[model samples]
Target chain A: MTPTKTAPQNDLPEVYIDDILMTLKYFTDEHEVHLKIIDPQVCMNCESKPCVQFCPVGAYRTQDGGTVQIAFQSCVECGTCRVLCPNSNISWKLPRGGYGVAYKFG
Target chain B: MSTKEKLTFDVIVVGAGLAGSAAAAIAARNGLSVAMIERGQTPGSKNYFGGALYTHSLLEIYPDLWDRKPPLERPVTESGFWFLSKDGMVRATVQGGKMQNDPIDAYVALRAKFDAWWAEQAKKEGVFIIPKTVVVDFIREDEKVVGVITDRPDGEIYAPVVIICEGVNNLLTQKLGLAKHDLKAHASALAVKQLISMPAETINARFGLPSNEHGLAASVMGDVSMGLPGLGFLYTGVDSVSVGVGVTLEALTKAGIKPYELLQRYLNHPMIAPMIAGGRLMEYGAHIIPEGGWTTMPKLYTDGALVAGDAASMVNALHWEGTNMAIMAGKAAGETAVEAHQKRDFSAKSLSAYRARLDKTFVMTDLHQYRNLSHFLKSRPDFMNTYPAFLNDALGMFFSGFGKPKKQLYKDILRSLTDRRPLVKAAGDMIAFGRTIMGF
Candidate 1:
């Protein structure tokens, strides 16, 4: 028998809302969260920019002039951009407690 | 306090993920004073999965949970298996009665909320959950594990039994000498998933669900991985979709394939594109699942401690079921701990009952039966590369009517199978696969 009809829908609120609220609270003092690395020039700044496409929440975006920018507020820290990136441009780690994407259904 | 204020509990459970929460819940329910420690800020903040909860084992633990409001999104009504080629899909579907039942055959959930709900349940059952607390090391009294040392200030907890439900990265298990430190990449699978947001109505309509019902599709990318051993899946939830790909880390390293690229290819596939179109990607995460099954399971019990969940490597990948096994193992471990506490014996000999209980249960049975399947799949490149292409080719020819008769289509299919491995090998593989993994 097909198992499609039996899936259940949760009535709770979206978990990401909490994540967003937490992010807001975490970055209340700062506009942007920056990463410290040995060399900013290490980023090859690939024309295609795979991180922009791989980011689930569009935290990484490419400007018209082809510069990559990260909006830390939306970053869920799923680590996809770091693992998928061909170059070691993104230094990823877990977000502070009560911050980042709070999945309601995870 | 000299930075060493010691605390005590009847049981100490590490990692507040699904399995740990279940273990803590069961232990507390059995009237044992329990301490559940989590490294994350919350129970599920660090957890990731292509989430599907098989309710069988959960119902065994909480029989009346479904009678009230379940922390479930949608009841899965349909399931599909797709063998995908470069541009086409060869499909097989199973639907109806047996899959829909009282305890809910399966439910898709977001772990962050689901896990928190589960942890809250455990707390209600009298589990003292210490969140944001990292268990740094196993406190050894002689050769036996007597307690754990947390990173928190004044955080040494003494317990007769410590249940390690620490997921795939079992550092403490290795440190405590319960499991081997050197886990081969072949034994681990790297899975990456994304939660895509969509309107609930849109999701239900797109997946053809009636009201709150849901659908799931598990796809095998034949030759899509360039001969890597892995698969992809997409599960429909209430307001979103969970889609991901998992490949053996060794195979991925060898092939130089990126998991996200595999995910993109999966999403772009003709068969998958329509279903997930217009959905905004909401969350993305990755995890290493111990796919070694029974062979990789550690020494489950040691002096003064027991192991459960992924720390014990209890995942059953054949059915894409791990959470259920983890929950069941946790429950069993909790029951065993309770028994030991009553008898006041936490020696390795007494705690060995956890292993016995697991052996008699479906967790070990399923794991042992499918123990060889991962190896078989890893060894057989054709299962990942050739069969999918052949199936898609045969199906394409069978369905196309380009001024050709049915007999001609049959001849075309026979021709497609000629240069490939002999039909005998395919038949043998199928039989072996059914016997070992499917237990048929």
Candidate 2:
């Protein structure tokens, strides 16, 4: 439950998403080559960028040329970008068994 | 393994999450030649959860689960719920082992380790586990799904029946038009979580836990999501803690905050920061949960196919359980498929028994009871927002002990709350909340 409160002091937790992802790289069972780019025509000029708005990992983003870009490696397989895309444009599939994250402490 | 063999079985279970594993294991044990197709290299590699597992139903399937000595993190013997205000907090906690014969209701285990063990168990029971194979779509013949088409070369595998347990995002269900093609974001909650590294001694000192006892299962609200109906949870492992936040998808999108950023906000909250003061982050990930309860459920069964777990939307959101429901649902579906296999009938009529089985279990009963929960929160977002703030303020005022008159203190507290939301609205909200949760 997100609650409103006084501002925080910006004390950094010793954790970093980059470092966590790096550690996950060691446990990866296989190299990922499964994810496919969605039809660019549908994503081009897309302003709301629903995929960007809902992805928890910030994997999807609007790029310089009005094209949508996604970093599959950063995905923890949350599937939000796949499920909540307004146009249903994200053609998501399961990363090959053992190819994606082999979570050490899931 | 390549698809060079005749790839046919009595039943094919897709996606090796908890639900798929349960379905495959149960079906194979019941004398059905089951093929458990996993998109992961093994079970649990593609799965994630909130670090809690109710073992009652899982135990029902593998009565000797402990005999194998699976990689259980710790037997969860204590839990708490924290309602936080800016400076103060109110908490209610339960001691697990206190229930004399409850037999350890749940445990904390890492999914990657637990799932791999579970899939291995299924493989031992004669279930053909095809790891690293992705089931891209179903092969239907005359309106009956007879096989699955994977992404591999000649990846079509035929089966009389198929159990779809593809987690929350059931793309196969969507392709079959079982669920909506344009499902809304609000239908699920977006959960982002991290695993933090903390020494066992530090955990014991911090949570006041005995060396032998397991760690706490604590939940937090307020000041974690900027007044959004998001929740932060903390569950400890032997050497780590799993901390997470789950906000309604609609709320997160409307707030325009990245999930990681919100998670950082939770980590920085004055009340929350101290709990994990010296811990280092180890793992981070996110998932969409079926918190919409029964209301957002898709069709459970069709010709030659049945959906279990998140694919069937079987999560009891209020109770914070999906794995238990998945286990029970998969068990029921497995039993139903066994019946169908005996009769050689792969029709929806035969599979309706799966629904009947769920109806008799908490999976469906509790789901139906709280079918209106998502609606309630969507209508009145303040129960998680305004009420918490007011409650915190009231507690702070009443406990200040500044030598004010008791009667005046009580009056001031009432007046403060009523002034913010009015007595009439408060009364109405109470009634509404009662009706929504109590199922009036």
Candidate 3:
């Protein structure tokens, strides 16, 4: 429960993405991946991986091979990557019925 | 889990959020067979909002709203703006006993509870609510929408008319080529919020609420979003607080800033840190808001189909109003559907009544009035960054000028204004401000 990191020059606590995601509830559809990269090569040719920064839940990450990896399990279903992707490389759809994030106090 | 029987209704409404439920409820009340399809396990399970619900819109659907005891957190007795700089803030709060009375203006609402209660009410009105079902696309016939295709096996549900209230992502609207493309990043925002739980007594004391029944709704601008065209919101619930930030996706992408990181920074702000210091995190959520105003709104009606709520980009962003707009639009759409049924004509020409009805209400008028606000804020970064900081600096110098000559203090403030921006830039701001106000 310790502060993951501290804000520079301030006493404010910096919370990690995982710590935040733990507060949410999700019913994952293990068989079906709702979010997919239409082409990994399209993502690689792109210089700026804005998805890593723009995703509110940090669902998109950069792998060592320079490909963007999607940790869709933790996605809050905000639909940011579907629209914000510069190359429109994301093929996004809602999770199956009774699946995906369910907010207890949304 | 699969049904071979044909399912049909007079009207099918996608989504069970504020707009969908309201539309279905009204359509049923008008004696039409209605079905509301929800993607979540329940109506509200997949929803998230910034926590304030205005009463005027809901009252139009249910006159006895407060009497039924909806799932309201607290009546908003105090609300206003907190213009923040990095180190200081200028707060403007409007509170009174009048706001605490019945028929109150607004309340803090948790969508998970509120939307569920709304669906229950819609069911009471004889609307069949299909839960845990996602509508994949419209069931089109002869270039007209006749029903919806859900994710379930053989899940084709038919109806004479379809109303799409499926929120800001609005894939269904795009599939029909109503909107040209997915909303650009600049037209929408990525908002992340955290619900921090505390005792009711603790919340009362921290927020200076008169009692547990009273609450505060505050909107913040300036350094909270790091000078982006965004806003920060804090709403007091019965025993929890909702604190969040919504930054334009365009700005976030351009700046390469993580929205959650910005939210963390907001939580620790000097002006904001103390309120929820020791509370436990209850839930974290995010949502997309349509901030494109009137200009970006898609065509509201087509043959045998109509769009309402965030699906039509019906958000009055400057006023922090969306649910109210959605509810109003839903009511209109429902009435229009009932009218179409009465005439036995479900053509594009007949469904155009939805837009005509909306045009007569404040939903369209207010949106038209504030049409330029989103564009104005996005185009001018200084309005979000430079002006608030300058106000704080000027006020800081003036307040501490007790020992100095008053005239000299006035002179210093005037000097700082010019030093912040050239005369031409200031004049440009004045003209732009006029245009934004006039909404040309």
Per-candidate DockQ values are: 0.10, 0.41, 0.54
Compared with the true structure, what per-residue lDDT tens digits does model 2 show for residues B72-128? Answer: 776778876777665656776888446223557777778988888888887888899
lDDT of 1 by residue, B364-428 (tens): 89998888867877977788868888888887887775788878778779878766878788788
User: lDDT: which is higher, 1 or 3?
Assistant: 3
Model 2 spans with C-alpha error above 4 angstroms: A1-20, A26-44, A48-53, A86-89, B1-5, B96-101
Tell me the docking grade of candidate 1.
incorrect
Best-fitting candidate, scored by lDDT: 3
Worst 10 residues of 2 chain B by lDDT: B96-105
The lowest-lDDT stretch of 10 consecutive residues in candidate 3 chain B is B1-10
| Model 2: lDDT to the true structure | 0.77
lDDT of 3 by residue, B86-157 (tens): 989988788886766677889999999999998899999999999889999888789989888999988899
Clashes of 3: 0
Q: Could you give the DockQ of candidate 3?
A: 0.54
Candidate 1: TM-score of chain A is 0.56
Which runs in model 3 stand beyond 4 Å of their true positions?
Answer: A1-14, B1-5, B97-102
The collision pairs in model 3 are none
Which prediction has the highest DockQ against the true structure?
Answer: 3
Native contacts retained, all candidates in order: 0.16, 0.57, 0.77
